[model samples]
Target: MSNTSRDAVLARIRQGLAAGPAPLPPRPDFAAPVHPPLNNPDIVVAFAESFQRVGGEFYYCESLEQLAVQLAAFQERQQVGPPYVWESDLQAVLQAAGIEFLADEADFIANADLSLTSCEALVARTGSVLVSAATESGRRLSIYPDQHLVLARPSQVVAEIGDALRVMQERYGAQQLPSMVSLTTGPSRTADIEKTLVLGAHGPRRIALFLLEEEENNG
Candidate 1:
């Protein structure tokens, strides 16, 4: 074998070793409202607004398509920017929403690219979005970029952390799970130095939640 062939084989072996722990089953999509109702919209609004209160900006949209629009616009406003990768599922929705997809990759790379994605339920109790590494859509789009935007319907929001975990176990079996599952609550925050809560400490400085309402339950 050539030197390049030996190098390729070695790289693949190292990659496998670093994959870490048993894999969780694929991220499962549960059939529940993406955004559950709160006794007061104030509670939900407050949860969303808390990000801004701490210096991070939050934008809530009615649908994924609206999110795509706002996401693209946000990139345009930034002095320094995160790469924009739109989820392909979102692309179809964007087109229908009247936003055109640019032909040039440069255009997207220039102003917010998008990655098509699907996510498990968002937990209502803590406003944390559950993501499993086992799913491609679940991984890169949320973490790689400097800013993260999650589009979930009210139907996918579950009530608590345990509920989200239960759903994961059901799909992947107990033995097979990702090395790490991230439960992100708002943006990264810390109050270490002077005990002043600071936002965007470890992750994106912005987060937007779109509570898409369904007709069946206005109750």
Candidate 2:
């Protein structure tokens, strides 16, 4: 086409576009649903039921000494020498009780029979334990071992995932957030092979939680 004809066509197209309907108004943001705060009993019950449904074992310990006794009994039944533990108060307790724990040896850790680690928070809504690379367990300790044991206090339990995340945020400020966060619900399982359910397909076959409850001081 000639230059004059092309310019006339472009002008007509622009004029037609300008005469079209105005753009639609922006949609209003939806209001979020409100939920009431959950009581401690409700949260604990929810966590227990959810965890059990997903093939997790739960134990209630009155104190660290009781936890140690239960752990010792478990170790004897499993016939394992010592578990791989992170640097924490639990380790000290075990040591004091003459229960050995392997140091941070990467090679040995992968082959260890069990791993004991501390979690940042427990989500009652999902029955999940929140962990992070910032903790002593890191990543491999929770995943590589054949069995996993978690030591959590009653105070660490939260009503939902949001509360658990908030705990992490407050513990480690925005600038010092951990490299990774893991929310583990239960023992690893898979139904990928011919729809046959198999446990420990990718991770530990067993997971046990020892919930330590301390007495409140009346004073």
Candidate 3:
């Protein structure tokens, strides 16, 4: 570079350095919600509507008996074989209802047609289910198989993601948060191939959630 050009560049550099650093941004209000407010009066209803809109099957069961009936009908309608269930509580309930499932690990690995498990919480606004490593369902049951089923109660429904997060915080203290926390809003889908949307490209093609109302006696 010529001496005159070098001097000009050096002068601009010095001028820029003369100005002080930019002011720091204002601190955010962590207590206040950052996203759009979720104003649903009934989170369970909101969750069910949103979940179905996202191509998920939602069953609102007033009792365990109703859940069993609805689930059996769903299975028959879909023509899917026995589901893979691992949770002891879910297994017991299904067993009592005469609903058959494959609980063997080898069977799951060999034939993972559908998986049934419990979730931590359900987000109403986005119709997402929050699962953590703390929950047994957070394992392969949530992501593997062609279809995924979740069993939860109305008490676990929250108005929004933030509310669901607070529920988790209360469930597992800060120091003991799960290693893997995920929110599943719908079935796995991608539009990467020829810009045409494809379901179950990488994960379950179908998703189902059963919300069982808490029994009055239990509450």
Highest lDDT, which number? 3
Candidate closer to the true structure by TM-score (higher is better), 2 or 3: 3
If the candidates were sorted by their lDDT against the true structure, best first, what order would they fall in? 3, 2, 1
Q: Higher-lDDT candidate among 1 and 2?
A: 2
**What lDDT, from 0 to 1, does candidate 2 have?**
0.80
lDDT for model 3 comes to 0.84
Candidate 1: deviation at residue 37, Å?
12
Model 2: number of backbone collisions:
0
User: Can you list the residue pairs that collide in candidate 2?
Assistant: none
lDDT (Cα, tens digit) per residue for candidate 3, span 125-163: 999988877765556888888999988888898888888
Error of model 3, residue 51, in angstroms: 1.0
**Could you give candidate 2's per-residue lDDT for residues 1-219 as a string of tens digits?**
999999999999999898997879987656743554443466777787767777788887776567778888888887776688876776776665566788677667447788888889888877898888987778877888889888777788888888898888899997888999989989988999899988889988899888777445111
Q: Model 1, range 92-209, lDDT digits (tens) per residue?
A: 5556556554423465434543332345666656667777776645465665445565655556666667788988888788898776688877666789979998766776556554
